[model samples]
Target: MGNHDELICAFLLSGDKPGRELSWQEVQDWTPDQGNIWVHFDCTHPGTGDWLRAESSIAPYVLEGLLADETRPRCDSYDEGALIILRGVNLNPDARPEDMVSIRVWADSSRVITTRLRRLMAVDDIRNQMPTGKGPATPGQFLAKLAGRLIDRMGPVIDTLSDQTSELEEALIGSEEESNLEDMRHKLNELRRVAIALRRYISPQKEALRRLNHLDEDWMEEEVQGPMLEVVDRITRINEELEEIRERASVIQDELANRLAQRMGGTMYLLTLVATIIMPLSFVTGLLGINVGGIPGSENPWAFAIVCAMMAAVGIGMFMLFKKMKWLTIPK
Candidate 1:
């Protein structure tokens, strides 16, 4: 684990034999001439930093980048090795997918070193495949495989956002409930935010992969170039899909806002019509309350009944007039 003092894993790769795990002592003693080695470390570990500073002999700038707390996707070739930083969706328990995790790599022809504060499934996939003699045989192939896995996992998450947006759009088409519309509005906003966050890393990562594929290096030879090109294509599509999802979410959000506004406007209009029809009837009744002698049949027992009947007829007539003028109807 990145939080621990131990090196995560160290493997000595034998092209024909299954990869063998190396102890800390063995890692310290190993060299390029013995065999190609892959060393993974928890960057946060104190021991890891001390070892890298004293033994790794990495350039100051590259070491700083590898140990930095925050980094965007990028590739910088130094000497014979390349320092690669890549981001993958955070798929840990209780984690938000949009909060991507980054892993840093320093890879050359014979030796590959990787560091991360957080564990990535893509790294684990490489670990699993190595023991079965089916994993990448070279540092270049390893990077390509890892990039592909990161992209492969992203497909479902992007598809999920697209599906949710579609479902919300359909619900908006059929939903008459104001409450449901309000809920959809919140969901659409959240979905759009996630899409933007995912794109933040993905866009830069696409460029990084492109630069890596085109870099003139011995390690990035013919066989490595082919797999890397595929990785570049996949990330490109992931970026495009995220953009589409963002646009679709925005359209749905706008449509929802307009519909909710019309609904509220129609309701308020109906209320205004009711108040208009009642105003004169209220005035007629209020007139009887005016203190005066011989107030228009106030002494007669039938006066109250006549006033009630008159108010009823007036209200009905006003309602019918409003209907005829289309004031009582709301446009669909």
Candidate 2:
């Protein structure tokens, strides 16, 4: 709505109404004397004392086209009726985008009106599912049906995330190599972001529905109330499961980091030991090689063999000392 280019809002009135569709411009010039039940669309401006009114903060022309962004899902009710806000899912699993499709619906006894800043999959899905010659009888019923389908669509998406999380857990257990660990970490973070987004968007709408359930409005009948409650319950459960998955991912990340650190420390210790053993040997060889003066065993024909034997003895002694201190591990 902020900077939207084109807005289109249409209303489908009750069967008794003369015209099937009424545009905002038409409503502005329309006179009630025409024997028509008025259903106005693109009426985003603040209302005066009209018999039935539907308005939006979003630009009116923005409702009818392809949406290039994403919006968080939400729901709200006014003094006269209800408003449902929904975000469309991006089915491409690998693509991460902040923009989402948004649909806003406002309804009353005689009319059902939908407005949007961008095209959404759920909106289209709901429109397509509407049976011929049987449009929504009331706004509440229309909203309930939309909410139910939106929650149901999320089932497959949540299932995919759960399966991916399980696969990551398996991979982590089987291999703790850097490459595998990094990949798993990336995937887990992505899943966490999706879960967090879903929870953030859907929570408000769930609360809205709960409020609607308590309202004394006549339009909110059993057909509307029952499905709305079910959708809310499903969303609540999904949010809880998402939290659990996030915790597991965090635990996996911490464990991997600790394991990597320990492995690095062990490798460093072994290298230091090897370097210490070689230092003394290098000194002994260098000093004995000096030809100028009294070098012990330098003049002997078997001096080289004596040097070799001496080095071996020193090496073995150091090895034994290290073994005693529990430095070197012997394979079983």
Per-candidate local distance difference test: 0.86, 0.59
Identify the leading candidate in terms of lDDT. Answer: 1
TM-score of each: 0.92, 0.71
Candidate 2 lDDT for residue 172: 77
Off by over 4 Å in 1: 1-4, 291-294
In candidate 2, stretches whose alpha carbon ends up further than 4 angstroms from where it belongs are 1-74, 92-100, 131-135, 176-178, 282-309, 330-332
Compared with the true structure, model 2 gives a TM-score of 0.71
TM-score of 1: 0.92
Over 1-332, each residue of candidate 1 has an lDDT whose tens digit, in order, gives 23346499988766457888887888889877887888999988888778888888888778888898999999988776899999999898899999999999998888889999998888988888777887776787778888889888788898898899889889888998888988888888898889999999999999999988887778776897888888999889889988888888878888887888898888888788889998998898888889988799877899889989999999999889988987877744
Q: What CA root-mean-square deviation does each model show from the true structure?
A: 2.4, 6.5
